[model samples]
Target: MITGEIKSQIDRIWDVIWSGGMSNPLEVVEQLTYLLFIKRLDDQQTTALERATLLDEPLVDNPFRLGKDELGRDYDDLRWSRLKNMHPEEAFDVVANRVFPYIREMRGDESTYAQHMKDARLTIPSASLLSRVIDLLDAVPMDNLDTKGDVYEYLLSEISSAGKNGQFRTPRHIIQLMVEMLAPEPGDTIVDPASGTCGFLVAATEYMRAHHADAINSGKWREHFHRQMFHGFDFDNTMLRIGSMNMLLHGVEQPDVRYRDSLAESNTGDADAYSMVLANPPFAGSLDYENTAKDLQRIVKTKKTELLFVALFLRLLKPGGRAAVIVPDGVLFGSSKAHKELRRTLVEDHKLDAVVKLPSGVFKPYAGVSTAILFFTKTNSGGTEKVWFYEVTADGMSLDDKRTPLLSDEKLGALAVLTDEEHGKNNLPDVLKRWQSRNSTEKDRERTDQSFCAPKADIAAQDYDLSLNRYKEIVHEEIEHRSPTEILDELDQLEKEIADGMAELRAMLLGGAE
Candidate 1:
């Protein structure tokens, strides 16, 4: 049930955001995040204290550490109870003074708020607004990580409307699909260079736990998972902070998510990089070559998402490292010089494993751009091998014909079908049926009939136009096959009907003349 309390609280929060002078939704979310984290921390400490006292634990080691004043009133450093005493605007100012200092100090030279602090003010709504928000948050239980995750996810979804700061967050289901396909092993180092809200990081963590539950529960998980495996980087400080908080909420302690413009050479050199890079890099944004060239390669490799990120990921990945990335459809078939060069590099220099073409409406609510997923491995020079291609015809559903929630559909599962002994031979008939129908040649020439297997020669011949639509020919079923006589009979019946209608019209005209 959509509880009234939750909806009302959400509305109030929205009202506050609109009422406040904050222009950016992401910025508004940032302010809310700061407040929420402080409140939740205090709540947890309070609960921890209660639990400890109930169990008769030692009083010397209080996790909360709430300070006390001379009048017997608790003067906890930054708890909501103490802040509640001040006016909302004043309270937010105080919070900014205390909490932000800690954050900036922790972030050192790389803090996003560091420069903004010069002119930063905590001006917000009135005390009443703050109090109501606090009351609303109080209703939420802060004991479990999943609960916190649910709240965070909702907030991200709410603020993910398009054309907001050039940020269109990737859908969670798509993130889940990538993580599941990659199958990040427990303790495997995972990184997202363009970590928007850390969706990939969170999904990767969940994927590991779900796949290797026993190992995760055995308590050695943290030792393996922490600084060793999970990593991320982004140019946006605001995004980095959100990503860090999100990783923390998802039980990832000390997430190494950082802020770095990866395309620049100097920034790339200064940054501590990663092994497996999974990212949907920002596209359509013009690159400042004068600045970015210090970190990014100067040679005009490609203008599209895949080429830019491919270069970056290749540089980021160690030898034999794998990369799965989301790219625009243009990268698959664009005839630009950079595009051809990048494709040649992938075929001749690296292992291009698979390409999955997603439906155009995948990002409906946020964006209507058609996209594709490219999975590849970083290797030395290699021959042209078979690359599996899957086209997702339906991407969930929508009631109002906008972006709808991601739902599981059996028909769309043909994209990730397995052929080898590892995934079992029996599990591939439906997919193979379509694949073979498209290409009947023993040499596997690229067929425009169905989504068929293509030979290297044919791909080279076509200049490597990898658009699935070009190859996956739609086969329309014959509608009620009829013999020549039956077709003639139907045409004769239709002719008689037309003749009778004409005769009635003529009769009416003659009556009028009479």
Candidate 2:
């Protein structure tokens, strides 16, 4: 959804940073995100001042402090609004020596964005580059929420489009499909354990704003939405800052995007805490048994990071809490005991809702590993009867490295209005529609169809292999039949023609001899 104007603005920032010799796209975004956060802080401070005055209260938690700092520069000068117009050297002086430390020492604020800024640094490389980035950032209007989101998304897209660190970028439409399927509610507690750039959290917020405008705008739910609704974990400090800023731009004031190695850390404190989980954790990874979390190890003894993430999701979900997670196809049909046991636990211990097969090309140009989405609810006892399965062959884009869109903006996502022919090119809309019919019509569909349901007993009989290919039936082309009378008439006419030709040849030979 990043348009040309926003794209160009971000592109200009990227160029400035690259010219300064910072080649890592994530770092470029990280530096830009920090400045954007500072600008946002100034705006937030203004709002706080007005509200405190209106309530006849003293301003207490301003991002800027009173009077002078250790360097004798006024604390006000450290703000983006004031320092942005200063001379390049002075601006760099404040940002490098003053602003960076100010944010780094911003430890008292309980907001999640502040939590991640504890180790923040200003790595914009040079004063001129910093100023150019600021001018570019200031020119693009962030006043509109939609434009703000578009800008952040474009900044993140540059990381993927750069072709080096694209593993961090999930296809935007895929994130939308997951969000739409989850349908976030006002009070729902959401978490993404491996939240690279927090795309899932951003999408969930957009969906909530679009679908539940009345409730989301109300004061009670609004407080929950801003303060406590979303959480994300990432070990990389740079990613944590970028992801938190992404949520902030999308209007969530304080998302819990903090530092934690999801697989290495214990889930004891957060066990059964969240109401819903949405994630696509890093996969095809192995961990030492000693390094893995004990609680997760207890879920199903394994070193596979993918399986451990699934265990973490199970522990994170409150009873009756649901999750929709993307996993490598190996998780579906791995022959390992851990894999079989995990699939069994989902079907027998809780409720396994669906397994959606994605095309192998879905993650192309970064990773070609085949993946699938698993939907389940955390129940103490078994509730799964029939588990739905869907195969998404195309996601409105070329299934290659280019990943070019095959449809216009309006015809791209899960809610797109696409015809049958168009649906062949993009299966997301159909996936969404058929997901709703999983219990009813999907159950009646033949295995040869794109989607169908399988009974729990059937799954157990096959050792709980959830791969769609295991259950999907291939459609065979029907054969054309011929009648015996038509075949016999053609054969008889062919025999008579052969006899007449033979007689003429024999007569000609005898005449020639005479």
Candidate 3:
């Protein structure tokens, strides 16, 4: 979690960007990400230099070469530490002319990060605004991975409104819940098909480091952690850039964060290629049949982006690969053939492990569409015996536009120490606990409970409808009411008492008059 002071600093930088004529929230964040990336390069170079000096060893590879560029400007001046001390005009000139191009030209061993920076542009409009933003960003503590990741996430949160293509950031707690439930292993290959800012991948990486620290430290696992374990795909260049930077700051050195429209292309080359998948793809968009991917259409013949994404998940996962992804509630019980076929595919064709229904207001102030998380495995044959269903009411935050935190910092996420009574206010921790025991205690739970399992036969009887309400029995409390005669008796008694009081009042008035 970012401190309030750090959040305020980020907000101030946002204000500067907006005042400088970059009113689009996405553009503001994109620009900030670029600057932060530049700053990170400088920080890395400085650390490398310090380590080399301490060991009295020469540097092996310097990202910052000590030389002038073809434009006759000193490359050393473009370093963040040196540029911050220059006059506003000189700072602006160097950044716009030198630093932007330098970063655009930077290449990693795999060149994924530099590939997305091909269109990098300096859009801060004025020298003063640029200078002020630099000062603000420089004050932020990006020395540690936790703080840096938090700061970047704080900045990403500013793009609260939905984008043109129905893209919006999934709530971090929601992402955490999915990642925790998935419990990514260090050796597992993970992918988020709609990797907006790579939140899912980042959360998975954090979970691995926290739980499987020893596995990550080994040479084999360490190599995977830095290079091949994480992959994300996004069509938007801006999102790709931001998502790539997000992974880098979180310490994934060479994540395959590249640009690809997951639903538009054939999956023949990469089908069944990943061990795990996690995503919350865009919902409710329609695509032309001719323009849609033929392979996805073959899996589920529909242009609905939601259904296509579900099919895409199946295609992307190898047999025995598991996935936890969010889908709109309509996918649960829609009357359309495509919807039914997809649900049937999960239940009868593969292992549909669980369906977690989220509250409608969870995506409030941007979308009020009810959604659910589908946990399933690609078995290429039926394995779903009993499907667990959990209805998540509160996720440690108010399900409103503001999404204010409902608990203190210490009592959040999987480690929340709330009592049973307090747990009612946040269902995340309970969800995790129950999920672990789904095969045992959850199997016998009644339909009226918050979470219960429904047999696959029952689901098939309903034509493969996965909506919790379809099978969840509501235990309506009986309301007792008074009989009409009893109510009349009480009214009659009150009326007689009122009349006696009236008579006594009249007698007293008459005696006084006499």
lDDT of each: 0.61, 0.82, 0.83
Each candidate structure's TM-score, on Cα atoms with residue i matched to residue i, is 0.72, 0.80, 0.87
Residue 474, candidate 3: C-alpha displacement in angstroms? 3.5
Give the range of the ten consecutive residues with the poorest summed lDDT in model 3: 144-153
Off by over 4 Å in 1: 1-9, 20-26, 42-122, 139-165, 213-221, 270-273, 294-300, 303-306, 399-401, 406-458, 478-514
Which portions of model 3 show Cα errors greater than 4 Å?
A: 1-4, 45-78, 108-110, 141-164, 214-218, 265-268, 478-481, 495-514
* Candidate 2 local lDDT, 1-514, one digit each (tens): 4544666777787777788889976666667777887887787778778988999898855767878966686888877788778998889888888788777666447777778877688877788888888888887666643343344445554454433322445677888898898888888999998887788898899899999877777757988887789999988776777787777667776788888887775546888899999998887657898888898888899988889999999999999899999998999999999999999999999999999999988776567888999999999799999899998988888878667678986788899999889999999999999997777778899988889999899999999999888888897899987899989998999998999999999999999999
Model 1 lDDT-worst window of ten:
422-431
User: Candidate 1: global Cα-lDDT?
Assistant: 0.61
How do these models rank on lDDT, best leading?
3, 2, 1
lDDT of 1 at 15: 75
Q: Candidate 2: list runs displaced more than 4 Å.
A: 1-12, 23-26, 38-87, 90-108, 135-167, 480-514
- Candidate 3 TM-score, C-alpha based: 0.87
What are the per-residue Cα lDDT tens digits for candidate 1 across 276-394? Answer: 77788775555545555433353344334346766777777776778889887878888888777676666667777667777776655445678888877877665556566766554
Q: Which of the two, 1 or 2, has more TM-score?
A: 2
Number of the top candidate by lDDT? 3
Q: Give me candidate 1's TM-score against the actual structure.
A: 0.72
lDDT of 2: 0.82
Q: Sorted by TM-score, highest first, which candidate order results?
A: 3, 2, 1
